[model samples]
Structure formats: structure tokens, C-alpha cells
Target: MGGAALAAGGLLLPGTAQAAPRLTTPSPVALDLPTVPAPRSERTAGSALRPFGRHLAFGADPSQQVVVSWQVPDAVTAPFVRIGVQPGDFGAPVAAEVRTLVSKLSWQKPVEDQPPVKPTTVTQYYLHAQLDQLIPDTTYYYVVGHQGYDPAGQHTRLGDVASFRTAPAPGRGAGFTFTAFGDQGIGYNAAATGHLIAGLDPAFHLHMGDLSYANAGGSGKTSDAYDARLWDSFFVQNDPVASRTPWMPAIGNHEMEPWYGSDGYGGMRARFTTPDNAWSQSTGIYSWRYQNVGLISLDGNDVCYNTPANLDYTKGKQKKWLESRLAALRADSGIDFIVVYLHQCTYSTCHDNGAELGAQQDWAPLFDKYQVDLVLSGHNHVYERTDPIRAGKATRKVASGDTVNPVKDGTTYVVAGGGGGGLYSFPVSDTYLGHETGNDKPVPMVVSERGGHEQTVKVTWSRVRYTGYCLVAVDVTPGAAGKPARMEVRSLTEDGTAVDRVTVQRG
Candidate 1:
């Protein structure tokens, strides 16, 4: 650390003592501030229009740090954030830290596909602040937003105040709970998923992507054709659940740009703050370690298949980082296990349609080499469990000297795409897969096209892999790397009722 670092709320300033670090952001909406632009309707109804947070998500900045983020609504407006310890109310000097969203950014074309063009007319602003040096396992309360904004429908008095408990730090703890799911955008099913999560009250929530669905209640109009949809309005409707939880996320095609190039994941990216200076600094591809669990997120939006350049920039970099991360973890030998999270799937019942990534063939080897414990992903929608294996072959050898049963105690693949978007039809199709040989190595589990001699129409697994939603609760019992982390996978229905449960016992 440096003098500047120390000046950054770490300790006392040059003259006086420094207060504890506060992580907070100003309200997202500005009302009649006479500063920002007004909507065409300007239906600034109900004198008490209040601005509240829109997509509240949290990520562990270590047991000592917590990153909080939300959108600020308009570019012209700035955020007013505050933070403090729990068991105490916010706004109390003992608990509050305030900061201004005064940072500016000038974007250069990404190295991907670059072409100079006019700057975007509309810019999205994000509010970010970090709560640091916090005590572990303690509750923290926070509130965000302003008192008046048109769309909020009314003047806001008190912003929503939510509390969360910090996870125990490494070496100082043994176990904890957190929820992981993907594809549950916003809608009837998504709302139900949210309820289940709220009930669980895990330390944090990770959405595997596909979080939007059409009409149940959202601001956007035509979001319903699968991946893009959400409740009534994908953006607004999705806020209820997210506003209270520190929702960490993964990506899916739903987050991709309709145009496929410029500023993809537009609003979503702008609305969240990720570790910008850490390893894999790109928001889409970042890594954060919480307690004993280290999560690595990827951007499968690499877009092209088999091409060296594409692999080099996207998957290649990810693979290299994975290797480095694994090597470092192995050398340390202290963490309970290494868990990898991403949006694409390696094991699926949907089969070949998603085979273009060749993740099973390419990434499986790395997972095995590193002895990764669990690999969670979305995009397929439905849920799947893979027999532990190393690169298509089983871990044990058969009499004939062939790998038997393929997978083992070391690692298992999970397809958790189902998060409320679209559901895919199960059973893989061989005929449809014939086309994939160019990009995919056929897995025995995929369904074939020819069953009946007369009429052969195979019911291939479609988006189900990505559509089937569920929340996985991992109970990290005491152990070492490669050891099973007692896990309970729960699949709930549209009403938040538990429908399926799978328990993985430790070896």
C-alpha cells in the first residue's frame, strides 16, 4: 500500500483519524433536479416521486470487502452513496461512509472488431462504491436512491434497506451457504426463483444468465422470443428480487447484442460494477475469491468457432488464466476446492446444438488437470449431472485397458441454464448433430435422428438446458482441494416449491 492508499480510508488521514470504509451509491433517479433531461411524457406524477436502485448485485471483495453496484439512470446525474456496519442503522456516523460518482471514462475500440464510428448518443451510467475492512460474519445494512423521479411512480422517502451477512474468511471458518442458478430472468418463474432464494438467504446469489423474459412486468416491450424476455418488463420487473440481493451474474446469448458487435450487454454491463483492476479485469471475465471459494467467470461470447484468432483472444486467454489460477491454487494447497463458473456448458442432455464450443473436448482436460471440483454453467437451460470424467474418457481403466465410467470424485459438470427464459425440448438428435461434426465431437448421450425406420423425427433437446432453472446450495464442509463440498441441488417449480433434490456426498 502507499500513502495514497492509506489516504483512501484505510486509516487516519494525514491530520485526523479515518472513519471505517463505507460502500454506497447515490439514488439511481434524479427528480426535478433541473439538471437531467426529461422523458417525452414527463408525467412526473405524484409529487413524491422517488428514485430507487435498479439491479442491486453484490460480490465478495474478500471477507473484508464487499462491492455494491446499481445503475444511476441518467448520464447527467451523479450518485450519492453511503454505507455502515449492521446491528446499527444507516445514516448513523458509526455506520455511514459517503462518496460521489465522479469518475469519467473514455472508451477506445475493443481489440475484437474495431471500426471508428460516432459516439453513442445515449450513455449508461453506473454507481459503484466499496465497503472495506468490514468484520467477517457480521450483518451490514444499506439503502440507496433519491426521493423523486417520474418513472418510480411516486416520490420516494426512504430507500429500500436490505441486510446481508459476510462470509467467514479463509482459515478462520469451516462452512457457509450461497445460491447459484442461471437463466431465471424476470417473470412468473423468475419471481418464484427469487422467493426461493430469499427464503434461503444465502450469503450471495449468482445468476447463470438468461435472466430476461417477455411481459410479466417490465419496461421494454418485445422481449419474449426466448432468451431476451423477462417479467412484464425485463429491466424493471427484474428489479424487485435483485434490488435486495447482491446478485452476481454470468452471461448467455440473451445478453448478447442484436447487432453482435458494438457495446454488447449494453444496459446490463452499464448497470453493474465488477472488479476492474483484478485479474481477468474485463467485467465479463473476472475472478473473485470469497472465503474458501474462488469463482472464475467467463465470456463465451467469443462468437466464432475453430478459428485460431477467435480462440486466441477469447477461449485461449480464458484457458491460460484457468491454468495459471489452478497452478497457483495447487501450489498453495489450502483452499477447500476450486469451482469454475461460466455461461457455456460441457455436459448437456440438449446435445449437439451447443456443441460448437467443444467445451467437453477442450476445457474438460484442463478441469481434470487442475482437479476442479465443480463446473457450473448455463445456456443449455435444463439441469444435468455428468459422471466425473477426463476428456470424454473415464477416470478408471477397464480390463481391456479402456477408461471406464469416465468421471470420478474429482470433478462433475452441471448445466444450470434454466432461469425463467425459454425451455428446450430434451433428447438429442443424431441427424441434426450430423451437421455438428465440423464443430463438435459427438457425446454418446446426445439423441439420434434415426429411431423409427418409417418416420424418423428425433425430439432433440433444444433450449431446455438453458431454460430449466434451479438454485444450487453448496455447503462447504471442512476439507481440502478436490474433495467434495457437500452440495444440495434443488430445483423449484414456478411457485417456488421444491421439485428435485440431488445430494453429492464427499469421498
Candidate 2:
């Protein structure tokens, strides 16, 4: 294999004798940026430490394990979490580990002769507590605090406590709901979406990627200004919903912070703890099974063409792991559905970012082979869905409210990018649940390819397109002895207006 192919984790062909090249992570970039302290407003007050940006994630097993993560503005002593089955009676204090991130700054000159960029250094402290051996299908109340600041203290208020429920045990045949979206940044719309998700009361949430746009530039190049504090605002904004629901996430191009690590995932690694059930060395790639549904989070940067900074960093291990995971999930009769989520679009018509051909070439075939039920993506800043597709072509047009059977038809792709980022436009007119712009002519759009080539192609699979801020809520009902499993997917705007709906079923 060629050097670029080998570097991107391509497998060697049979009868090839050349040894695989050794892969090494690039050393962190040193840009000599200035160091700054946490603003006075963010620091803790005299002995009263406050934790923000609280979120949750299921471990390898959702029924018996959960990882609780939260952030403190500044350094503190003896940080820990207290949890119990009752609201006011936490059993014992669970010590938490602190992950500290020192973020350096970089500036981008969009044009020549631009003035020098002034950047700020941001240091963040994140604490995590892993709770295991928990009862299934039960709600647990919890509070996060450090020395001299216990939320369970008699003087503390009721609002300080948050709760989360564990998923049902294996083969429980219990039904549940979950919400998903991507490209969510900190803003009024982002906060509104969070509230809408909270109202839905999903069992958990899937964040497709581009969580906090601290680095405004989506390009993997380190030339953009990096303001790490934007993460603080993002976490605080989503705290209401994330603190209560497991906020699972995939990594996107914007997540590639150049100054932190070789692939710019050091910050994300320190802030979130996801399931460690996939390739051991890969970040933002993991899988978990909750009742009858199997969820997989993939790192699109590994196979993206538009943003190739961390392209193929996995060395083919991620794809190999994905195939293996899919096979195992399919083998198990208990798993009735498989949903894969990533940042870049495998099939989208958004003129701004278009579709990622690398993903379409590398992963879509595996998706087809495994018969994945649903594929969710972001990075386009709009809501778009494709007809049930196989081999890059639409098998059939599935309108809003239509039901599809992946077992007979093909996998469905949804671009739920309207998760609070500014909207992007489609080459054609808008069409959604309540409104339809009767403009369905075939339009040419760009397809991002490896080596930075843009290919123009005309596509007809762009079925439902909504140019507004929205979130996707899915209700999963497990199949019984004589019945089939079903998932009802709904796209709702920021104000809880339904714009699109579809159903997927498997026998």
C-alpha cells in the first residue's frame, strides 16, 4: 500500500510482504501563547465552591454503570460526588478524579496582511466519578461538591440535587426514548434546544459532534483563534439537560483543537468519559447497548476529506472495530436496532459543507453490509434526511410520516445539524413536516473528497430539508414474541414544533 493509504489505516492485501509502518501520534504544537487565569466571576467564592457543566455518560454497560462528569471554575480540594436512591439521603461520598486541561491559543489570518491575533490561555478542571453495581431501571439522586461545599448539607437548597435513571437490564424488553442532534454551540437557540430536549425526557441524548465551537474555524488547521472559555459557556448552557441525561457525543472537525494534542482531542478526552468498548486507543469511538437498541459513536475526523487534520489517525483500527461490533450486535437477537452517529455527513445536500465522500466510500459500505437502521450526522447546520439508501443510491423515497423496514429496504441517513448552530442553506427550496416548497428539481452540489478535491454531483435522495434550529427525538419500542421492534423518529424545532417524522421497524 502507498504511504498515504497506510497512514490512513488502510489494510494490506493478502500475499503482501511489506511490514506495516509504525504509527505515532504527533507531538502537541507549541505556539508560545500567553497564560491567563480564570476570570474573577468564574472563580469560587470564599470556601463555597460551585460546580458547573455537569453531564453523564453510560459506561460499557448502561444498566449497571454510569460516569458522572462535572467542572469547577478553579482548583479545589477533595472533589467528590454523593449519590443514593433517595433525595435527601446519599449513602457515602465517592471520590472524584480531576482532569486538568491547559489550553493554548492560536490565531488565523483569513487573508494576507491581517493584524496579529491576541489569544488567551484557558485552564479548566473537570471531575469524574464512575458509579457501578447500580440497580437497573431505577432513579438515583446525586450532587457534586468538594471540601467545605456539600450540596447534601442541611443548609443546602433542593435545586442542588439532580437525578438519573439507569437503563433496563438485558432482555428486559422495555421501551424508551432518546433525543439526538449535532453542531450545538452556546447561544440562545442552543439553550432553547436544551430545554426542549429536557421536556421530552429522553432516556439519554446523542450529540453528533461539534459540541462547543471554541475554535470557530471548522478547518483542522491551527490558524484559527482558540478561546477555551467558550466550553465553559457551552457546558453551563446544557447543564439543565445534560446533568440529568447521559449526553453521549461523537467527535467532529471543530473538535480538532490543534494546540492540545496531535489530533486535537486532548480537551475532549479530559472533559468527557464515554464507553470504552471499542478500539482501546481511539477517542470518541465507542458502543453501548441499551435494552434492544445498540448505539455506536464514530470519530468522523478519521475518515473525513474536508477536514483531514486527523484523517486516518486510527490506522484502520476504528473501521475494523466497527465491523466487528456490528457483527456482534447483529448476531444477538436481543439487539433489534443499530444506530450509528458521526459528525460529518455521509449523504447531504447542504451547499456549505455538502457530503463527505471519504465517509461514503469507507463506511457506507460497511453500514450497508451490517444493515444499520439509522445514521445521524451533523456539520451542515440544517436538518436533512435521505430516502432509505443502499450502495449510495436511494432505494425508495420515504416522505415524512412514512415507515421503513431496514431489513427489506436500506439504511436511512438523517442530517440533524440544526442543533443550535447558525443555519445553512440547501441548493433547492425547503421542504419539511408542516411546510413544503414544491421545488424538487435535481440540483448539483459539491462532494468533498480526499486530497481536498471537490466533485460536483446531482443527487435526488435529499428528501426532507428544514432550514431551522431543531432536534431529533426517537421513541424505541422493543419487539415482543409475535410483534416487531419499532422506532418513531420526530424532528422538532426549537419551539417544540414538529417539522418531520418517520418510523423504522424490524422483525
Candidate 3:
């Protein structure tokens, strides 16, 4: 098989016989920024060059393509990936592309009251190998190596190799499970959650954004608190799970580093390559399909009224694209469920950051119109699930273990923000598995308004709220013709305790 290059229009072009594996060109934003060498202290000493932050992501079509990404501590002669159908038998090496990112020194403080910070310059090298034409429902083993090191050589170790299974073909009716969470930072809790998800053996994981929290301040403004080294810790912590699972991500406000680009997505684009099925070449907003399920990732910052720094950046283009994608998915005969995940919440009872009016006003209507099965978000650090909602009200109260039919009822919104971050409190009483405290009063929470303002509002749709570190796993059971498909959405704590569960069925 021959490798190909990704064209500017997101098409694959045949590579010449003599041409090495082609790489995607650097983004215009990255090309315009200046790059500098890392400080002596930050440079890799006399150690062998090794890869870290190894992770996988599905391409436009998960059934036939995947993108393997990793980072090197220092500049290497030639970095490549050796892949094969069997373990320890990687045939030929596929050349990898390097994306270099630079974070210059900053003396300004994120907050006026903070003390001046020391200056530091950091540079990172991210490598990616886009593997296409893979067999569906097959596992492929791979290892990363450079000129001085070879995994298949005599010095290979068991830990040097990793494998990933591609999604089944469309209409395959293959039952699969995937996990979702957000607001995961680098910490003990976060690491525990990663191990828990890996234990569940999910085919893929949806990171609802606020990934590394390198930028402690989520204001999306230029902050001196930003530390590029934090990303190193984050990837290392999650490498155990991310190396084998497709860790798909959504863009959150904390990901908005003003120093990166106009919309603050230059770093993200360089770090991870997502599906290119979005409008206007947006990296954060894209859609993909696996078996009988259709999944869409959105950039909530563009429509987040709470964080107005990048608000309306898309000029309503994202919403338009979303509607079209939803319509297409709803029209597809093979797609039994449509799930959307983003950073901010359309409805949440977290007092810190409740409902995002921007998203509710712009995208919720489309979810209702298309009858989306489930919506997931992670802005507030807690777990909350709403009743089947339509037109800003709960059509029916859906408790845990209850079944929901989006076609007849409405979409269900879930807030699984408790992904290892500090837990947040809700205006309503806590209610979940093993711990249930009923709340009869209307929960008074803050609603995001335009221009970075907040308004107090009382609502009764707040059903389940659990303040703890947790993640959500969704198991999809495909249905045959004339039968209804089922999806079991379960919320589990870092210790693997089920906090909440709900079944979604579609006819």
C-alpha cells in the first residue's frame, strides 16, 4: 500500500513512488508566529530520544482511517511509526510529520493582584502519522521510533508497542462502548479517572474540553499563568489510556490561549488532528460516525456568553453547519443515535457556571428540531443530568434507569464535568446512585448573558446532581430493521462506582 498526502481541501493525493509519506502543512497562524529554541534547562540532556503523549484520533471515517500522534523530547533525525496487523511484526516504517510549537516568555500577570512571573521560553515537537485504508473492526499494532532508536530492533520492550481497534463499518450492527468527560486537569483524581475509563475498555473517549488547564484562568485572555510544560505532565498522566484509545476532544474556554491565534486554536490544531468534516476549516468543530452512532464535537467558546472573549467568533457559521450535520445524520438510515459533546452546558445547575444562554439560544433549537438523542458538556466541575427537555422545559422527568425516546420526548442534556477536576457544588441538592437527596425547590442558578454578564434564574429541570470526580460511559446496542436501538449511558466515579444510569432508545 502507498501513503498519500493530505491536500489543502482535505482530500488525499497519491504520493509519488519516490516521495516519502507526506505531512499536512503547518497552519497559517503557526507559520506566521516566530519559533525559538528552548532554554538549556528545558532541553533534553544526553538521554535517548523517546516519544511521549502518544494518543489516537479517528479521521473523517473511523472505519477506515486513524491519526496516531505523539511528542518527542528533542529534535530527532527521522521520526516514524511502524505498524502491522500482528504484534512485534511491524512491516515498514511510515514517516511522521513534525508540528513545532513555541510558547514565548511572558512577564505579565493573569490577574492584576498576582506577582510578576519569571520569563521562560518553551518549544515542543508534535509528530503525527495519518493511517488510511485500515480494515474495519481490526486491531493494528504500532510503535514510534526515530533514527537512533527502533522498537523492532534487538532492544525492543513489551511496553514499546500499542494497539488500537478501528470502528466497525456502517450498518454493521456491532455493539460498542465509548466514554465521555470534561474539565480534566493534571492531578491525582484525573489520573485515577483515566485508569478507570481504560478499565472499561471503551472504543473511544470524548474529552469535553478544558483539557490540561495549562492556562489556569479560563477567561480566554492572555495570561502569564500559562505554562507549556503542564501539557507534558497531562499527556504523561493520560498516556496509559490515551495511547490505545481514540481520545477525541472538544475545545473549551480554557483552551483559548490568546497568544496562539486570533481565535486561540493554533496550539490545539498543532497538537491534535480531528475530523475535517466541519465548515470553514474549523479544527474544533467536526463530526464522525461509528457503526450505528453519529457523533459531533462543537466549539462552545464561539457561542458561550459566559466567556465572551471568543464569543460569536464563527459569525453564526457554526450553528448553520451544525444544523446541516444534524439534518444529514437524522436522515441517514444507518444512524440510530446522534450525540453531541462540547465544553459549555446548554443546561446545568452548577452555581459557578450554570446554563450558557448563547448555546441554548443558538444550538438547542436545532437539537430539538432534529431530535438529537443526547448532549454532553463539561464546564462546571460536577455531574448533572436533565430530564427529557423540549423548548426550554422538561417534557418528562427521567430518573436514573429510566428509558428515554427522543423522537417522542426530547433531547437529554448531561453535565459530566467531573473529570478529575475539583468538584463543584450545585444550587440543588445532590442526587445520584448510592447517594440521593431529593430537591423539591426550584434551583436558583446563574445564567450566562451576553457581554460576560450573569442573570439569576430558577428552574426545575435539574434532576440529578453529583459533586465528585467521575466519567460517563455509553454502550450502544445496534438494532435490526424495524427494531429500536438502545444506548445505556452510565456515570461512574473515579473508583468505578456507578453514580447514575439512563437508557436511550430510538425506533
What is model 1's C-alpha RMSD?
A: 11.6
Model 1, range 1-507, lDDT digits (tens) per residue?
001111211211221112222223334665534344344113233223233344444454556766555443332222334444642345522221222111111221222332343222322334445566877877776655432222212432244555556667666666766677777755577666677777776667777655553222221222313222121255455556565566777655455432212324333443455544224235466666666666766655443232112233353666676677767765554554567777666555564234323465457777888777777877666665454556554443111111112125446566766666656644543211112212232333442212211212222122112234566666556554876555554445445544344444444
Q: Give the clashing residue pairs of candidate 2, or none.
A: 9-315, 9-316, 108-223, 433-499
Ranking the candidates on TM-score from highest down gives 3, 2, 1
lDDT of 3 by residue, 21-104 (tens): 222334344654555534432343313667889989998799899999998776665678998899988878898876666666
Better of 1 and 2 by TM-score: 2
- Local accuracy by lDDT, each model: 0.48, 0.82, 0.82
C-alpha lDDT of candidate 2 relative to the true structure: 0.82
Candidate 2: list runs displaced more than 4 Å: 1-46, 105-120, 437-440
The alpha-carbon deviation from the true structure for residue 166 of candidate 2, after best TM-score superposition, in angstroms, is 0.4
Winner on TM-score between 1 and 3 is 3
